[model samples]
Target: MTPHPPTWIRVSECFLSLQGEGPAAGTPAHFVRLQGCDVGCHWCDSKYTWGKSGGREISIDDALDEVRSLGEAPMLVITGGEPLQHEGVYALLARSLGRWSRVEVETSGVEPPRMSHAHLFWNVSPKLPSVTPRWADTWAHARAWAQAPNATFKLVVGSERDRDDAVRLIAEHEVPAARVMLMPEGLTDDVVRAHAPIVVEACKRHGYRMSPRLHIWLWGPKRGV
Candidate 1:
């Protein structure tokens, strides 16, 4: 008999939605949103996931069963308020989605992810100081993975200072220009359009990719959208 794996994770929701950001934007995908976070970003859209006890605590098998019910998609996006909060999430992906799915993780880049043998595409968005407290250690971890081989570092620039900050972080982390993404910070359609042109121009000037927040445009920060 095989040993059963431990189940640990707070899941807010899961659904089929078009990829709303990064290299996979606009693509059809399955999303798994785990819960809990230590890093507090003021503008974090998913504040509902911050508490450990509020959301539904789900087993990996049950989560996979939900995914299975949806049939196959080209990719799966595992995200969270901080998905790495749960120890068992890594094994769950390895045992389940690793077989044929292209797995993508949208993270704040504060904690290192635990994944093995999956085509892991990491979209690492590090928080700005304006949104959270300054921690050299957390920033270090963000920098380390932000510059990892298979990861993309995205900085959400809301002001000129933010852009400059991202540039400095890139240098500090030794992240290549090719791997950097500059996304304007916006939570609404009007807000997105307002910031898009400026950030897009900045990306072109600095030779980085401009990541538009497609989820906001598609669903307007509505839950499960």
Candidate 2:
């Protein structure tokens, strides 16, 4: 019998680093940044990952093995320009089930999750009005994510309008307050710190959690941890 062909996906890069944002912040994780995205955020830190032009195609096995070679990773973080946009990601996660204690997916919630796993945790960031193709355009996907018990909401807020928009999304989607996290938006440590106070105050009043830019604090805008 003939062997099956290896599944491939465009990869921007892979690195073992501390999860920088969301509820899993500070946790040591092997990050798999798949390339390609259409939900454009003007302030996107990873504009380099906007398309397949910069990334190379790699098989799911090779991708996991590379991260494993990096050493012991406490968790696997499948992030992206938009991870769900890549079909091979579903296979990657399916294969990662027993390898990592848990798997975290950081998505813009623009594309729907095609499969669900018991140990998979989704950090769904619903885009606010500040970005094009923002939350209003893709909120249905977020609503779908909220329906899953393992999903968490991470709202990156930089202004009062963004904060208000986050609140409106939470209410409309019926997302649990305890499962919501507010992260400051910035590419530099100073900028992230400066915006943190607003997030802290917002979390305090709303009973939401605060997610720090731990990787930014540790590496200061550097890539690949």
Q: What's the count of clashing pairs in each model shown?
A: 0, 0
Query: What tens digits encode model 2's per-residue C-alpha lDDT throughout 1-225?
Result: 975533887899999988888877788899999998888887788888988677999889999999889988879999888888786777788888889988998888877766677888998887887777555756777767777768888888887778888888788878888889998888888888788888888889989999888877887767798
TM-score of each: 0.90, 0.93
Q: Candidate 2, after superposition: displacement of residue 46 in Å?
A: 1.1
Candidate 1 Cα lDDT to native? 0.77
Quick one: how many clashes does candidate 2 have? 0
**Model 1, span 20-94: residue lDDT tens:** 889878888888898888778777789998887777877787887786577667888888877766676677667
Q: What C-alpha lDDT values do all the predictions have?
A: 0.77, 0.84
lDDT score, candidate 2, position 39: 84
User: Where does candidate 2 stray beyond 4 Å?
Assistant: 1-6
lDDT of 2: 0.84
